[model samples]
Structure formats: structure tokens, C-alpha cells
Target: MNGIILASILLRIAGVGYSLVLLKRSGDRRFGFFTVLLTFMAARQVLTVAGTTGTGLEELPGLVVSGLAILTIHYLDRYVDEEHRIKRELKDTNEELTIFKKAVEHAGHGIFVTDPDGTITYANPAIESVTGYEPDEVVGENPRLWKSGEHDQSFYEEMWATICDGDVWDGEIINENASGEFRWVDTTIAPVTDGGEIEHFVAVDTDVTDRKERQLRIEDQNERLGRLNRMNELLRDVNRRVVTTTKRETLEETVSERFVSDPWVVSTAVVDRTASGRLRTRYVTGDETAIDAILEDTEEAISTLTAAVDHGRTMVSEQVKALSNDDITGDTVGVVPLSYRDRNYGALVVVTESSKLFEIIDHELRTELGDTIGSAINAAERRRELVDDRVTELTFAIEDADAPPFELAAATESDVHLTRTTTDGDGQRIVFLKVDDVDAETAMTAAASISNFSDPTLVSAADGACLLRFVASDTLADTLACHGATLEALHVESDTGDGEIIIDTPVGNDVLPVVEALSSRFDSCELVGRQEREPTIDTAEGFRGELQADLTDRQLEALRTAHLAGYFEWPREHSGEDVAAMMGVCQSTYMQHLRAAERKLTTNLFGDERTSDRRPAVA
Candidate 1:
């Protein structure tokens, strides 16, 4: 029980305790190595205390050395365990860093880091493709280098404010590329914070140029469609007004008002072509300032109007400036021709603040609206003529004419008389003419020789006079019809191409347009006579006498019954059977009489002198 033995024993116990703690904590087999040395030292101390070996002092050196050895092995084992733990931690850390590096380098979105002052410190590989700049080029520069100037300084200030407050900011940005082209990017910026203070900013950007452009294009197309729809609605309204209005002035005012009502049209003025070929503003509507602006540019306005009326074309200009001190600016002016079937009525002047109006008023819309209005005006003139008792008759002598009647008379040396003129489905002029001193074959042959005439055929022949049917282009009848006039008589003298044209029209109707048309087609056209007279109609007794000569009593009765019963009215007021019942006759018999009566009336009105073997003209 000396101090050496006691100390050795104590040292061995301490080593054992330490080894146990290490083993419990690490479960490493190396921790048991210190236990084996402690056991050897304990056995030596036991032998010296029992005196089975020399005294404890003699074993003391061995014990001391053994204790030291035990101490060294214990500490070494602990050191080795600590070394293994450090190596494992280092390995795990290296693996995690590798994974993070790979993710950052290969990310699809552009990733960039900037220092606190907004200078770019590092940029990922994807940044080059998105920004069109190399990583090295941008590393030392601020992100402002690629700014497209599309966004104002306030935009950047707001973004910086949000991110610097440790809040993320996201928006769409237009940035410039290295080649001076612009690109769109969806970007998100977040501040990297340390202890609630911003250290750096990290930005992720995705290229969205194609998608943004497509969206913009779609928006533009939608705007155009909207404008077109508005214009189409205005045109539809004008057509509706034309159908219901029976006065030229009323129709012009209505159309002008309709145009002015549109959002795009600031003002409208309808210019009329007078009989003397002079232009006059017939109706003006809408904003007074815009109208004054158009009037200010008098020369340009007149030129556009004249071109529309004379050339049958639409003229548009953006150079028409708005009046001074007016709210409107950069106004557009357009003149659309109003013409139909070789007749020029006038022009429609439209003033608009938006150029989009011109884009919508394409050629098709211009032509359709112009022709519709022209036809309506002509119809109004015709209605006025039918209702008015006073009529104006004009006679013109045409020399060197190229019409069928003139050519036929010159070629056959016969007097040609026009009996009737009409238009067929194809718009060709179908004329019936009576030629004296020529057979049917001779008259048709002569008519067929004219270049403007086609499909010549014989209608009938009696007493050395032949009724010939032919189709002609650019005839006097067509010209007179276009100007709301009716051809009363047309004759060509024998052995000469000179002809006389007599037309009847409303007293107030302009006669110059038709005369101009006639002059343009003939070498020498002169107004031979002008007369005003009251219109005359046959007395009822005389009309009844004429019908009595051509219609049977039963046919006349059937005709009179159907007419009074409103059978010929549109969506007929009475059916044929109903008319027959009213007449107290069987349906078939009454229909027979009605058909015969219609045939007689048509012949009486249109002059049917057709031969038995002849067919109606198809032209």
C-alpha cells in the first residue's frame, strides 16, 4: 500500500475511465487500445504489492514508464478520433460546396451578384446569353450598363429601394444588348442580408423578348379590328339612311352626320359636283374647329375633292394641320369619290384626328359606300322627276358617233329609229330599233359590224321596216339613265352617221353631266333644243280603248280584279286563287285570263313586234 503502488493504481483507474468515456462517445475500436496498456500497468502494480516481484520501487520505473505509456496511448487515441471527425466534416463540406457550385454554374436563368454599391461582382454563365455580354465584361461594371433607356430613373430607384430594404423586387425590363438591339427580360432582385443589413444583391433574369413581342403584336391587331368594326358600323348606318331618304340634300346631310358621329371622324363635308362641273360643299357637320381646319387648307381640300369627283378615286393626306388654338392636332383628311355606273355625283370629305381612320377606310369600303350613296341620290332624282308635273326636255345632235344606231344607219343607208332601250342582267344595253328600207337580215348584219354592239338579231319585219335587237356598250341611253333622265327619242338619218338624242328629266335636274358624257363619246355634240313642258298622260278612256283592242273581255276583267285586289303588290295581298274566287271564276280559268292580260299589257307598254320564230334577246 505504498505511494508508488497507489499512484499506479490510480493512474490505471483514470485511464480506464477516460477510455470508457471515449468509447461511449465514438464507439471506435482504437479507444480500446488505451485500456490494454492500463491493464498491463495494473498487473505490474499487483505483483509488486504482493512481493511476488521485487519491491514497488524496483517496479516503480517500469510503472512510471508504463503509466506514461498509458497516458500517451489514451491521449493519442483521443487525438486520432478527433482527426477522423475533422476529416469527415471536411469531406461533407467539400461535397456540398461542389453541388452548390454546379447548380449556380449551370442554371438556366441568369444569376448575378452585385456589391452593396450596385457594382456587379460576379455573373453566372447564363448572364452572357441573356444580356449579350461576357461575364468578364460585366464583372467590373454596374448593372446600369445594359439599361435600355425605356425605363426612367424612377424605375431603378424604386427597385433599389425595395431590394435594399431586404424585400425582393420583380418586374419586366427592356435591356440593350451588345449589338445595340433591345431585349426583354423578366427579372427578380433580392438583397443578400447579414444581421438584418444588406450585404449584396442577387438578381435572376429570364429572357422574354419573343413572348413580349407577341403580346404587343396581338394588342395592336385587336386595336385595328376595333377600328375596322367602328367604320363598318358607320357605313351600314349610311346605307340604311340612303334607303329611307328620298331627297338628295337629306341623304347628304344624314351621311355627313353619320360620319361625324364616329369617334375617329372629327368632321365631315359632302362636296357636290354641280351640272357645270363645279364643286360645292353641300353639307357640313361635326366639330367646328376641325371644319375650320379643313377650310384653312383650301387648295389641298379642293385638289382632293376634284380628284375624287373627276378620277373616281380616294385621296388621303396627313398633312392637313388643325386650326391654330384648337385642341385637335395632326389631323387627317380624306376625300372619297361618290360615283356609280359611269356617273360621278361628288366627293365626301372626312377629317379625323386619328390616322387609324384612314387605315380602316380601305379601297373596298370606299368604293362600296361611294356607289351606294350615288345610287341613292340618283334614285331620289328619279323620284322627284316622276312626282313633278313640269319636265325639261333636251335635244342633242351627235355627229361622228360610234353607237350602233349611227353605224347601222351609215352602213345600210337607212333611217334607224330606236323603239325601246333597257339594261340586261350583265349591264349591257339592249336596244330595239326599227330600220326603214332594209330587211331584218340586212339591219342585223349592219348592227353587228359596230365594235360596241353585240348579239344582233331580228325582232320582226313589216312593210319594208325591220325591228332589230342588239346589245351596245357606252350608248346614249345609258348615259342619260345614269344622270336620272329618260331617253324620249333617238334617230339616225340615212347615208350619215349623225344622230339626234332627246331626253326628258325633272325640271331642276342637272343636265350637264349627261351632255358631257355624250360629248366625250362623239366627235361633235351640240345641244340643239331645250324646252320645258308639263308632263302628259293618256286619258283613262283612251287607255281603256287601247287595252280593249288587245285584251279579251275575260282577260280585262281578270286583270282589273287582280290589280284592285293588290295581287301585284310585294308579298302579294291576295293569292291567285283568292282573286279568282272574288271574280266568281274557277282558279285555272281566272289564271289563264290573268296571264293573257299580262302578256298583252307588256306588249302594249314595251312594243312587241317579234316574229313567230324569234326568241327574246339574252343580252
Candidate 2:
């Protein structure tokens, strides 16, 4: 009995110590109750072993305590096992959280967490580089701190609505940084939900300002290229119209209509300033309101138009009230000068509703279009003058010693008379001139000294006159021809090298432009005379009379007799002697008369240049 009691007491003591440890570690009420039961059993066992038991009292206490302890120990073992399982799960959860936190901290893109109200709760280190703000500064602040205000309130409202509904929101946002510079960010925001309740929101942002700006620049370049192409096509069409139209009025009307036909142009008007300083509307198309507006302010309108015409420049205005409409306001107005080779004829008024047209019609386009229209109008006017019969004669006294003809005459001390002027296939002028008081060699030497004369060749010389042929460019004849005038007669004096020129044109053509052009080329030129005259009845009959007068009676008789007797036939039926007998003259005399007549006729038929093989030296 003593051994049993002793063993029971030792075992209860061990149980009590283990139970206390369990209670401290688990802090469970069941382990505390088990510890109290184990202490009672240990004390009861000690009492029973100390010989203090009677009437089964000690045994009873020991039995009850031992039974409670055995039951508590069973429950305590289960409690301890359950606590160990929970500790293992907690360790796994903490390790996973550490990995996620490190990933968020080291991410390249800005990662941030916000509460349901968009207040930033946490931000990664990358937020400093992305938003120009440190993580600490962003935390506990509203995301609106970086708002650039480029977007309206509705933009943020819509984004909030989507995120609040637990859906992801993705878009590009323009935000201001700490430095007050706008930045473009591609952002994705997702709601973090816990058990069907919103906990927080997670946003990942990428800085995309550079990429967005580059895309915008590319789009701008492409738009400019497209506008340039459109302008080129329109210019080509205008050029084609200029080439085909033959009347000034028709060309003006056509050009006005063509400009109005463009989608951007709302109206076009062509106006000519008359010599009396009056504005005459030549051709008008599209909206008449714009043109009426321009004319309403007469002084201002005239001033603007005159500036373009006088200066021969393009004028653009954005403040024309008449050009504005209900649908499109601030229309652009352009006044393009119509001038050719420095002569102003009119101005073309254009009203455009598209700003792109302003960009398209740059300086180059304006100048080119003005030149095309001016040239076309000038050509059409020339075509009209060509078929008229009434002639205007202009006589200009050219005293410039620099003129090639005057220079040659002054150098050789001779009178130079231009006989004829013709052009070769290369468009170079071939001039035939008779130099009196100079031999063929002296005339050639004088011509060679002039810069305007080239390829001088002596044709023939006889009786104090030398006929010379040479190539001359930019002479009085060429200048007059350029202005639709024909050179009628030219003469240079020997003593003073003074010269007179006579040019003829259709009666209605303007002589001022011609005179001005000539004056520009030769400084000492003066218009000494101008007259209108009717063409004489100089037909074939008159030509025949002139030819007869050029020949003597004997020469005429020889030529007529030879023609009637077949002396000119290839196999002559009558010889030169036979024709001479019919004409009552010797064969040698008849041949001499015939040869002289043939020479004169050939000179009249061709240009007045006669060629001979012999070249005479200067006298």
C-alpha cells in the first residue's frame, strides 16, 4: 500500500507540473481547470501516504481528484494539439505576406493602395519617380492632389462610379506633378474586396507622357502633308484652266468659280481697278454677302485692294465681317494680286471658311497663283488684238549710244538703216541692215565691236552702201514684239548716233506698258510720236506696180521677152540671142538687163539681203 501511494503521489506531482506549463502556454480555461485537479490529487496522495486516512476519507478525496484529473488530461491534450495546428497556419500566412510586401516595394510601376474614399493609404518607392512625390508625401492624402484639371469633374465621377461598383478602371490620365508640369499616365485601378465589402483600391500607373507627345507630333506632321497635297492638286487644276481659257472675262469668271468650287472656300470675287480709280467687279461667285460687305466700306475696301494691286502682293485678313456666317465664324479673307511680269491688272478676293486653307495657301502658292492668272489674262488680251485691222503707230526716238545699231553707226561714222528682221528656228533674230558711208569690211568691224551683235557677216557692198547680216538679241524689235507691236522702220544717224523707231500695233492696245518696258531697257528712249491709221489697199496689184517701178524699161523688156519666147525653159526653144533679137538688143546687153532684174526681184522676194562671194577690205 505504501509503494502504491508513493508512486501515485509522484505521478500526480508530474501531472501538476505539466498542467501548469500547458495553462501558461495556451492560456485556456480548460488547462487551468486541469492544473487545479492535478494539484488536488497530488495533495490527496500525500495525505493518504502520511497515514492520515480513516473511514475512507483520504481514499475518497484521492479517488475523486484522480478521476477529474484523468478526464481533464484528455481534454487538455486535444486543446494543445489544436493550438499547435493554428500556430503552423499563422507561420505560413506571415511568410506569404512578406513576399507580397517585397514585390510591391520593388515594382517598377507606381503601386498604391487607397481607401474607399480615394485617400492614399500606402505607396511604393516608385511613386517618387513617377509622380515627382515621395511615398510619405502621398500617403494619407487624396489622389486629387496631383490632378492637372485638364479633365472635367465628370471624368473623375465616372472613374469613381466604375471602381465603386467593384469593377476595374483603366485609362490614361493627365496629372500634374510636384513640379507643376503636366504628365500623362496610363493607370489601372481595381477594388480590393473583403467578404463582399470594399476594403481598399489598388492602382498601378505607368508614365507615358513622352510616348503621348510623340504620337501627337506625328499626327501634326501627317496633317500638314495632307494639306500640302491638297493645295498642289488645286494649283494644278488652276494652271490647266489658265492655259485653256482664251478671253480675259471668261478666265476671270472661270477662276472665280474654280476657287469657290473648293470645299473650304465660301466665296470668290475678281475685281479690276479701272484707270479712273474705280473698282469694277469683273467676276463674282458663291456668297455675295462677303463681297457686298467688302464694298460697303468703300474707302477701306479700296485701300486694301489698291495695296495689293500697287504692291503686287498677297493680303490676308481674318477680320472680315461679311465673310463670317452662322455656322462658321472667323473666316479668312485673301486678296491675291493678278499681275504678270510686274504689270498689275486686278485683285482676286477669296473667302475661306477653313483655317486649313490658310496653311495651304502659303507664300509660294499665293505668288504662283497670281502669276498664272496674270499671264493668262495678258495672253487672252493679246489674242484679241492680233486679229484687228486698225493700227496704232508709235515712233520712239532712241538716243542711247549703247544700242547696238547706234553704237555701230557711231563707231563707223555711217548711217544705219534696218532693212528687215527675221527669226531663225532657234528663235534668234537675223537682222539685215544697210550701212551707208562705210564699206563691207568697215561695217563688219563696227558690228563686231558691239556686244549685242553676233556672227556679223558682210552680204554685199556697192555705191557707198554695205548690206550686213548678223544675229541680234534683245533689240528694239524684240522688245516691241514682246508687247504685240511690229517693228515698221528703224534709222540711225551718222553724226550724233541718234535713232528713230516706228512700231505698229492694233489700235486699242495700251501703249503705256510698252513705253515703260522700252524705257526700262534703254534709259534715253522717248516716245516722240503716236498715231492711228487705216491699212491701205496694198494687195497683189500694188506689189506688182512697185516691182515694175524698181526695174528700168530695158530690164523690164528683156524679162518679158525672155518669158514669152521660152528662154527661161529648161530645154530652151529660144536662146538668149533669140530673146535679145525679139527685144531689139544685143545678147550681152539683154543678159545684163536680165541678170540685174533677177537680182532685184530675188532681193525683194527674200529678206533685203544680197550675198556675193567677194569680200572687200576696209577702205
Top lDDT hit: 1
Taking the tens digit of each residue's C-alpha lDDT, what string does model 1 give over 304-384?
667887788888877654433358643678888877677777788888776788888886778788889988987887788
Candidate 2 on 109-178: residue-level lDDT in tens? Answer: 9999999988999999999877999999999998898999999999999999999999999999999999
Q: Model 1 — which ten-residue stretch has the worst lDDT?
A: 610-619
Off by over 4 Å in 2: 1-92, 113-117, 164-167, 191-202, 247-264, 274-276, 284-288, 294-305, 319-330, 384-619
- Give the clash count for each candidate: 0, 0
Q: Candidate 1: misplaced stretches above 4 Å?
A: 2-12, 20-97, 152-154, 164-166, 222-234, 273-280, 298-301, 323-326, 390-619
Q: Give the C-alpha miss distance for residue 174 in model 2, angstroms.
A: 2.8
Question: Highest TM-score among the candidates is held by which one?
Answer: 1
